[model samples]
Target chain A: MIGTFVVARRELSGLFMAPFTWIVLLVVLFINGLLFSSFLYQTQGNVTATLSESMTGPSFWLWMIFLPALLSMRLVAEESRSGTLEYLLTAPVSDAAVVLGKFLAATGFLALLWSSSLIYAVTLDYAGGPPDWPAVIGTWFGTILVSGLFVSIGMLASTSTSTPLLAAFLSMVSCLMWIAIPFLAANIMAYLVPLLTSTAAEQAVLAERMGSVVASMDALRHFSRSFQMGVLDTAEIVFFLTWISFFLFLTARSIEARRWRG
Target chain B: MIEVANLTRRYGALLAVDDLSFEIGRGEVVGFLGPNGAGKTTTIRILAGYLAATKAGRLVVAGHDVQRDSMGVRRSIGYLPESVPLYPELRVEEMMRFQGRLHRMDRQAMRVRIPEVLERVGVQDRGKQLVGTLSRGLKQRVGLAVALLPDPEVLILDEPTSGLDPIQRGEVRDLIHSLADDRTVLLSSHILAEVESVAPRVIILHEGQKVADGKPAELAASLGGGGHVAVEVMGAASAEDMSSLIGSLPGVESVATGERVGIHQSFEVRGEGDLREDIGALAMTQSWALRELSWQRPTLEQLFTRLVTGRGLDELAMPVASGPGAAPSSKPEAGPAGLSADAPVLASGLELSQGPTGPSALPLGTPGNAGSKIIYSLNPFDRGASRDLSKPVSVDAPPEAPAEGLPDGASEETES
Candidate 1:
């Protein structure tokens, strides 16, 4: 790990040096803050209820969808464009170390972004009757898991191309498709049962099975639910870590291929 | 120490480097000479471990295998690519420090090494300045300083003096020469003069293959005949008259006028041995008021052209007589005279016009003739003409020829 630290340090320092990172950070935080405040007003001082009812679900999803695009768009894309990738690859560092360092740096940045949303948590505590502290903490945890997953997907996309915009778009598309498959499958199952069945009983049986499958799929959507409830689930943590490691592995392979092609 | 054997790199269909092999001993400053697209950069990149060769080859750097132990090799070698990529926002000192950190150099070592390298490359004062803000020359110096960090055993620099002014180029050359005391330097450059002054041995790459490799003088003498002597006259004597007179002198095989004549007339005398004294005496006898008489050596440019273009000054000096007004008595010897045994004649086969034999026969197609004239050949092999002729050739006349009619024999007597 000394190699990992060196790569991570260079990447982190580069992020600070570039104006794009700060600009993205300010814009993201501004938008997130505005949304949070509007969410507060929509609740009309009932902060705890607002968060549990509507804010937690949508805000968690929003951060999941947007954070990855923001943090990972520059991971491999910027290095490739600036030609620093060559320097890093040629250094006395393994490709895995390079990829891990960059991934961790993006994850750290996402954590920082999540930390900025602590003000919303504070508002809920001060204004509302004793908030569901466990739920609030769970939501934060779920948001981290989801954001971490998205960051990995984004890094994979970034490694696929040298253009930041393309990487962001591809990452967003992949994330949307993964989440949207269950919804699409539900709709297809609903339409197909009416066409295939004659008797109401047969239709009922088919509908029940389809409902079960949809329920299982929906359970997958609750992958971050435990984190939202402030419960540390081994399975959920493993899922996020696994996702991060898988994409990082892919990014490392891409970099290794580049050394041969460089 | 570095060794590359059968190293070939292919980018899709384009072969960037093909079957290249060479070795650089420890502390040897070897200059890499090549024209544009000659694959010099590709070779250096492979050696630096920035690129992996497509076809497997044995590339060892400082006893570490580049393929198996690339990190070790990379740690031991420092590379400066053609375009020095620097973090624009980082100051020179910061960049150096960062590189040192990446190399895992201790803070104390960096504190001492950074300033020393900066001073050695003449960029000590610019350490606080942002790298992007520095001029190209200064940036090059900064790039050199960065590569000099960690005290790497090998330093690979590609086109180090590409955009520098004369003074800066000289400074860089001097710095490279001074560094030769401890480090092995492999530098690629298009500047022939700088390579000559700095590099003791040179490896020339042409179309991805190493065309020539040896000491600069050994390679030059091997490719072409011995050096020639160039005489610049400021008197009334025309280069045509001087060419004929010099051509007739013993030990002088051919006399060709260089680019600059009259106020800057240059006559190249090619032979097996030095003929400086003979030319000086001839100048004195003719009262030609010689402005400059110096031994002209074969430059890296000549060797490079001879390797890449397959032609040298000797081939370019061949007699060219086209339709009509061409004199029959002007044909000179067609074959090159003093070529080393191993030197390959670029355009060996096709024959040009032959001048009739006579005392008045002018060496037609000879590079620089009596008058301030340049002769062109239709053959693609005959090119790379130079006006600088500091090296002279002394010709030995046929033993039966009338000695009384020949000019001064002072220079010729010393030849053999």
Candidate 2:
């Protein structure tokens, strides 16, 4: 355990000192700020009328998608590229601790990026009258949950390839699939006749159920209703945490397999 | 202490290391000597715990099984590869601290140990410089410094003095010698002098097997059939006459002649039995003044070549004088002033060719020449001789060519 902590601390500090971290941070923050400010101006000041309303919507979703690309790029990819992964693996730490340490550090960086948007929250309170505190907090929770999922998925992608650019691309593609496949399935089913859909459903029950569940699970709607309304949902929180764990599990397996192959 | 038994490592179909085994006890400095591609690096890597053996063998480091307790083995051992791997981004001090931390050294120990190692390796001034900014020798010193960080019980270095200047090489050799008071070091090198200087015990590897192992002097004497004897004489007889007399003396197997004047001659006598009494008697009978006569030991070079070439030293000794039938009566008139009587004879039954003369009248081996043809079939050393001495003879004379057309340039070059 002590060895794990030592490795983790050194690795975390290494990332902080690396130029790639600052470049990614500056680029993501600039792009996110530009998009959010543009959206607010386009909405003619109504977008900033309340912190909850401003935080919940496509604007926040854009932040979720773009932030993952930035923070997850170097998680596993840089270590492999630099041959430091071998050094780390040969250390006295367990594989789980290595994956978790890196995962937590990347998540922490993403959280810091997300926290910077608090300036906008403060601006809403000052200019648009007292902001909606419950909604603002709920939206922040959803963003964090989504970021956690992204961090895990990014780690998996990093472990899968030695190239950082390739890892980032794979992570983004997988995340997009997770977000888009459900919507695509729901739209396709909406146009399908009952007789045709029923025949396909018999062949693949799980696929049909997945499509239906994805279609009905309105992430933004749930965010506004439960989280924005100050109503915490056990199922939603559990869902996010489960995804995080599943990807982390995959990352652990990848790291273990490297020892044998390498 | 380290013990490796039947350790074998294979990459695909190539056997990098083949059932190699050796042991180093506490406070012993051992040299691993071998030619390139002879598996020295492979053996070092396995001992360092950097690579696992394909076919596992019993490998113990400081009482810990290498495979089962690699961390313990790592903690107890220090390794420096042929090309040291270092982080260029970090300063020397930073890199040392990081390595110490990785080895689980506490803050207090690291704070004290880093500077001590840096100073021991004589790189204290370069601690603030990035590793990439240092010279090759300094980087090598830093590599040694890092290896010493954990105060490991065993140190394994591969080609430690390679690429260093003479002074730096001496410094590193001295440092390695100084460390003998506490730690066991296993160093590998192709340079015979380096091994002779640092290690008293040598293990010579050839084609993935231990060909020779023992103290340097013992191995040299065993391989050469016996020790060497250096005889310097001040006599009225020419060096050629002295060498011939020495060659014919009892117990003298062979004689190699050096520079000579009217009464000054130097030569090397090699044989299994002592020849000092017989040589002294011959000098008295002939009334030849003997200036110096001392027994000389065989060198590491002779030992190494004998093992690698699988040839006996007696067979390889230069033929100072031909058999009785071929011996010139009263010794043929000596060549130029500086030429030794036992030096290579230029004239032979083989025909000589002509070309632009460089240094001598020797013919560079032509495709159809009998000498070249005979050389190729005789021995490997003969082939090396042809490569070093073969040159096209000049039909047109150049004014700069040395008189007497003797093969003296190469010999003088080596002496200088």
Candidate 3:
């Protein structure tokens, strides 16, 4: 565990010290900050009424997933590409430590990217708008949970090959698919419900039941909608924790396999 | 400190390291020598406990089984890979701390040890400098520093002096010489002369198997290869008379008449042992004033030429007869194993016409010529206005394990 933290510290230092890391952070923050301020302007003096509405939009979710994927894509791939992975894996630390170290660093940056919206939240509160603290906290939770999954997925992609660009491309495709899964499943169910049922009433009931089941399987359902409205569900929390561990465990396995393959 | 048996690593059908076995005791600095594709790096990586040999190979490093307790083995070994890969974002001091932490050194110990290693490698001033901003030579020093941070029981360096300029190379050699006294070091390089200069015991790999493993001098002598001694005599005697006069000695194999510059008559003497004393005596008896007499140690090029003539491992130079279970080819081209029959090389030490045996103007002396030069300690720490490093108990050092208590014959295991 100590070795894992040490590796995390080294990797985190590497990430923050590089110009690219900082440049990417600045650009994403600037872009997100711009969008937040525009939402604030749109809220006008009735900021309390629409704070949750503004935070739950498409741009927030998209940037949360996109930025983390971009950042985490380099986590293992750059180390392998630069030949430092050889040094890293050869250290007395376990393969899991190396994997977790990189994951920790990428996730730290992703969290920073997601939480930068606190500036807008603080501004709204200072201007006499209700703090909407519950919504604010919930959105923060949902954004991080979403970014956490994307970052871990990106990390897994990073380990599959030594090419950073390819890793980034893979992680992007996977994260886009994460969003598209729910929509795809719901659409397929929508198209099939009418065909599978005879009466119109039966079709409506079957569609509702199938839609809820498929929607529950979609990892993002509760977090993006209900959680952003300040209603955190235990099942959504469990889902986030479970899948993050799953991806992180896969990342560790990928790293351990390098010894056998190389 | 290290032992291996029947180590084999195959990249697909190509055998990179084939059934190699050797032993290295503590306080010994051995050279892992070979041309490209001879699996020198692979062997070092395995020894360092980073890479695993294919199953059924037994490797013990620092008293721990490399396969079973790899982390323990890694903790005891300091490895410098062929190209020193460093984090560009890290400062020299940061990199040291990073390695120290990886080795599980205490933070307080790391604080003190980091400076000590940096000082030892002669880079104390540059600890704050980023690794990327430093030159290759300095980067190598930092790499050496990182390796030394743990004060590991065994050091494995892969081509440590490669790519450095001659002066830098010499400095690194001197540094390695200092470190060999108390700690064990195993360095791998394709250049035989580089190994000859630093390591006393050499394990040469030909086509990923041990072709020769012994002291460089022993291998050279057993192969009928040794250096030459040339004398410049200014006298009335003809070159033919001088040649015959020097050739009368038992050991002098052949004497060649050299340049006739004005009144000076030069003769190149080739033979075994130190013929300098014999030639000087002949010149004294004849009352001929000899201007200069120096010996040129037969370089590894001589060894390669003998191999080229099929005197050594002829199959080593043979091209891969065919793929998979076919005759392994030290290939003359497309990498080493496939084309060795034609080029007979890929050996790097041949470039220097004047190799390690040329002359040492510095107080640093070769293994056999200890008394001839002034006392100089290769140890940078012992530099209190120069001290003799010839003491029985020297500092933790260095390369070239003295040829003693070691197997006289290299383990020759055919490809299995």
Candidate 4:
């Protein structure tokens, strides 16, 4: 565990020295700030009301995917590319510690990026409106959970390959697969099994129940409204936690798999 | 400090390291010498805990099983990989600090130790330089500093002086020698001289197997055929007369003459026992001048080439600056005991191409003919070919350039 922290601290300091990190920071801030000003313009400059919705909307999920993918690509890929993976793993540190340290570093950077949204939270509070502060905080937790799961997937992708570009491509692919595959599977089932749709009477009730069961597996149900409204749902948090573990489990296995080669 | 038994590492269908085993006692410096792809790096990687050995093998580093207690083994060993992977963005001190921390050093200990280690490796002035910007030599020094961090009980360096210049190689060799008083160091290098300078004991690997191990000079002598002796003969009738005089001695293998100057000639007496005293006694009875007598130990390169590829030392001792037959330096190789023991004879007298500084053949090489021959040996007292300036070896131009102009062109190119 201490190894994990040591690696994380060094990795964080390294990120600070990287120009790419600052570039990402500048670009994300510029774009989000533009969006915030546009939100004000759209609301006729009413900053008090549109704060929470603007803070946790589609732009936030965009941050969830692209920003974390960029940060996590280097977590495993750069180390292996630079051959520093040998140095890191051969230290008196376990595979889990190295992987977890890198994952936490990426997550930590994502958290720093997300903290910029707190400026919006403060704006809402300062504007003297009855802001949905609980929803803001709950959705903030949900955002991190979502980001962690995505970054873990990115890190898993990075662990599978030595090239940073391939790692980045794999991370993007993995994130999209995680976010879209379940819904795609359910949609395909709905189309192929027309009988899964409701008709009439008892058979129709069973078909509708089955369809709803499959649809409930869609990721949208958890975060679409309940998380957006700051309902603090345990189910969404658990889903993120489970998926994050699954990605991290695959990542640790990937790291160990490299031990087989030169 | 290190032990291995039946240690084998296989990469799928290929055996990278065979059932190899060797031991190094505490504070010993062992050089791992091998041709490329000879399992030197693979074995070092296994010892350093970078790669795990196959289940059939047993490797214990510093008393910890490599495969079982790798972390404990790693804690005791500092490894410098062949490629010297370093974070380019990090300064030397920063990298050392990070390595120190990774080794579990405390904040206060690291603060005091980083500068000390950086200075020890002679990179203290470059501590603030980014590793990417430093020369290969300085990078190697920093790599050494990193390995020296935490004061590891065992140090594993792979080709520590591989790509550096001779001067840099000397610096690294001196550093490795300094490390020998306390830490057990296992280093691998293709530079034979660098190995000769630091490691008294060497383990030579050929095709993933241990071919030879022992004191380097002993190995060279035992496997390197009979060592040769440099004998300058005077007051003898002819070259054959000198050959017969020495060849009759017990343990005398063959007699090859060097620079046949009239009544006097230098003979390389190849064989076993100390025939010098016997030759001196023969010269005493025969009323000949036995000006110089010295033994030349067979070089490790000869032993290694013979063991690895069944090639003769003369063929393998091709000029370092040029390929075989083409001498790297223009310096004549004859007069003094020839570096290429069989260097081709030139017009009038013979001119020899400078190669490995052969054993001294003194009183024969006169000073005025320094242009014809220059003999350099580790022995400072290597008296020049018998100072008898009477029958001087002709200091002519280089051996005839091949009729084809390309030989001349190659020499000109090398000069430029």
Candidate 5:
């Protein structure tokens, strides 16, 4: 546990010290702030609708996808490139501790970046219309869960390569597939599966099964359906948590594999 | 403090560290010597717990089995890799503190030990500076400081003085000597002089196998011949006649002519024992003016060449620079004067290009020059062989050509 925190502290300090971090933060916040104000204006100051659209909207979702990659790319790739991974791994810390520490630091930084949205909550109170507190809280929780999964996936990508640019590009492509695959899977089941099945009854059953599976894997649907409207589902939270653990576990295994391969 | 037995590490079909075994007692400092691709770094990495051996037979360090208790081994050992890697963004003190925390040191203990280690490595004043901002030498000191943070019982340093200037190398060599007094240390270096000065026991590896292991003096003595005795005389006879007189001495094996200035000619005389007195007596009898007469002791450099290439310096004692039969490839038509003055280096280069011999002279395990060529063929990525082959030729080439030809040409240009 101490090893984890020590690694996390160093990683956090490193992230904060980089000029890229500030530039990303400045640009991301500036863009998200504009999108938030524009959404509120279009909705005529309707806090509940604006909060849902701003938090789970397409623009914000795209930022969540790439932001984690940008934040976690340097976590391992840069260290390995600089040859510092040898020193870090030779320490008394376990591979799991190193991986988990870096994951938590990146997730925490993303959460902090998201926290700038609290100004929207402040703006709601000051403009003579208080925001929907339960909706706001649920939206924030769903955002963190989604961002944590992205960060863990990005970390796994970071561990798979030594070049920071390659790691970032790999994680970005993986995140894109993660979101786009469900939609593609749905279209395949709806159109491509029917050509193979002769009976209408058989096609209906197969399409329903594929739809249920794809719907469950769709992260945006989970956020938009329940958490966006102040509904917290235990199964939704567990789904994201399970995927995060799976990726992080693979990351630790990749790090341990270098010892044998070298 | 360290023990390895039958430790074998393989990459695909290539064996980086072949079946090797050695032990270091508590408070003993051992030097690890090898040519390129000899598995020096691989062995050091395994002992430090950064690598795992394919067949880890009884590998132990600091009373812990490296395979079973790697954390314990890591905690008890301090390692400084050849390339000293540090976080450029972190302050020096912050780096120390982070390393301290990783070792599970308490706040009170870290408060005292961090500064103590900083002072020990002579970087006490640079604690507030960023690691990336410091020069290479200062960064190396910071690396040493981090390695010392745990006050480890076993220290493994690989090429500690690799990139330092002469004075800095001297300082680091002295520091390693001081640090070795009470702790068990395993140091690997390409610089034979540094190893000869610091380590009483040296283990030389050739082609991932242990070739020689003993004290430096003992290793040199086992070659069974005294070192060369250099003499300068101003005689009335011609240089060839004077060389013949020295070569005819009782114990003198051979004599190679050196630089001639006016009427004074220097001769390097090799023999069974010190031939200075014999040469001096002959010079006095012939009424020759003896300018200088000194007997040189056998060096670790000669021992290494003999063990690695199976060719002793005595075989390389021929006057290649002036001899008519010298290989054309051995001559560097355009090179620095310093390299042209290095006759033995040119001779070794000539010997390496000779390739392997048929089954005649010696068996496989012997220090035959055949073993080196075979080993070079075994690993295509062997940097040592390539470096040794090109090293002399590159030095012979214009110095600027190498700098511009390197892969990091852009960085060199920017630096200049």
Candidate 6:
């Protein structure tokens, strides 16, 4: 356990020390500031509705897709590229600790990025309007869960290669596919079942089955339905945690397999 | 502290280490001497628990099986890799503390040991400098400091002075010499002088297999009668009579006349071992004045060249264990089974050039020749009449045994 913390601490400090990190932070916050102003302008200063829209809207999903790639590209790829990974692996630490520690550091930094937007919440209170406390809390929790999922996928991608740029590209493509695939499957099923089935009743039955499968896999739908509406659903929480744990397990195994390949 | 048995590693049919076996006891500084692509780094990585060997192999470091208990093995040995990799983003002190934490050391102990280790490697002033900003030599020193942070029982350093300048290499060699006391050290180097200055025992690898294992002088003495014994005698007999008499000795192969000063004449007697004692005995019996009798030992460069080319193993008479199936068989006169027919080698192309016989040709007992030149310790086999005196002791001893009763005569004599 101490091995995990030691690695995490070094990785976190390394992230903070890089000028590129600060540059990314500044550009992201600047864009988020514009996003907050545009939402307030569109909603006529309805802070609660604006908060919900900002958390679940298309622009937010785009940021969620790209942010993790930037945060986690160097977690393992840079170490392997610079040859520091040998020193790290030869230390008295298990492969799991190294992978988990890097994942923790990236998730922690994602949480910090989301926390910086609380200034927008304070701005709403000072403007003679206040956000619904439960809804605001739910939105933060939902966004963090989504970011955690993306970061773990990025971590898995990072462990697959030694080039940081290639890792970032692979991570971005995987995140895009994760969000787009279920919706595409649902649309494809709806269109194909109508042409294949002879009777309307049979078509309806197959569509309902396909709908349930799409509903179960569509994480964005669950995030918008439960987390944006001031409700914390236990089923949704279990779903995100399971996927995160699955990816983290694969990342650990990938690191262990490198020794054999070498 | 380290034992490897039939250790083999293959990367898609390119065998990196081919059934290599050697044992290093506690408090022994053994040098791994080999050329590039000789699998020295691969073997060291396996011993350091960094890379996995084939399943048929077994390795133990500090009483822990490397494959079964890699964490224990890692904790007991400190490894400095060939590249000397470090986090360029970290400060030197931060790097030390981070490595210490990985070793599970307490904060208080780290606070004291960090600076002490830095001082030991001669990098105390660079604690506050960023690791990336330091020069290459300083970075190497910082890497050494990190390896020394845990104070491990065994130290495995691979090419520690590869990229450094001459002065820096000397300093690092000196540091290794000081740290070698009471610690089992296994260092790999392609530079002959670096290993010759520090390690008393050497294991030479050629094309990923053991070719020789013994003291530098012992390996030199096994170079198929390449060593020469220089003699200066004052007698009534002519130079040819003395030369023929010396050449008739049991192990003598040839004789070359050196500087002739009136009645006093010098002769270079080439032989299988040191023929100085035999010549002195002959002079005593023949009533000739024996003015000078010095054994000119072969340098390590000569032995390394001969062994790496695969020709020396055929003629190596010393019974150092060279193959995995070799036992402590006490066959002193038989050659090692290390040579294969397909080994790429030029067949014994060394022509015994008479004039330039290397640094060993510098005649001893001349004015100022005592301390100005470094005379490596006398070969143990040189003390006896033939090359087989020390072979029985080395061959009869168990290969995997500890350092309790191993040969230390050459190292001890050099110190005095």
> Which ten residues in a row are the worst by lDDT in model 1 chain B?
B343-352
Interface RMSD of 6: 0.8
Query: Model 1's lDDT to the true fold?
Result: 0.71
Give candidate 5 misplaced runs (Cα > 4 Å).
Answer: A190-198, B234-272, B317-416
- Model 5: per-residue lDDT, tens digit, A32-51? 88998899899998887787
Candidates ranked, most accurate by lDDT first:
5, 6, 4, 3, 1, 2
TM-score of chain A of 1: 0.80
For model 1, what is the error of residue A49's alpha carbon versus the real structure, in angstroms, after optimal superposition? 4.3
**What are the lDDT figures for the candidates, one per model?**
0.71, 0.69, 0.72, 0.73, 0.79, 0.77
**By TM-score: ranked, best first:** 5, 4, 1, 6, 3, 2
Better of 2 and 5 by lDDT: 5
RMSD of 4: 10.2
Off by over 4 Å in 2: A46-104, A122-201, A204-262, B224-244, B255-269, B273-416
* Residue B302 CA displacement from its true place in model 6, Å: 3.4
Q: Which sections of candidate 1 miss by over 4 Å?
A: A52-67, A126-129, A184-222, B231-245, B256-267, B283-294, B315-416
lDDT (Cα, tens digit) per residue for candidate 5, span B199-238:
9999999889999899988887777355688888765554
Using DockQ, give the best candidate's number.
Answer: 4
Candidate 5 residue pairs in clash (backbone atoms < 3 Å):
B310-B367
- Candidate 3 Cα errors over 4 Å, as ranges: A43-50, A185-217, B225-297, B304-416
- Tell how far residue B11 is off in model 3, in angstroms: 1.6
Q: Grade the docking of candidate 6.
A: medium
lDDT of 1 by residue, B26-131 (tens): 9999999889888898888888888888875689988899888988998998888777767777889989988898888999999999999999988889889987
- Greater DockQ among 1 and 2 belongs to 1
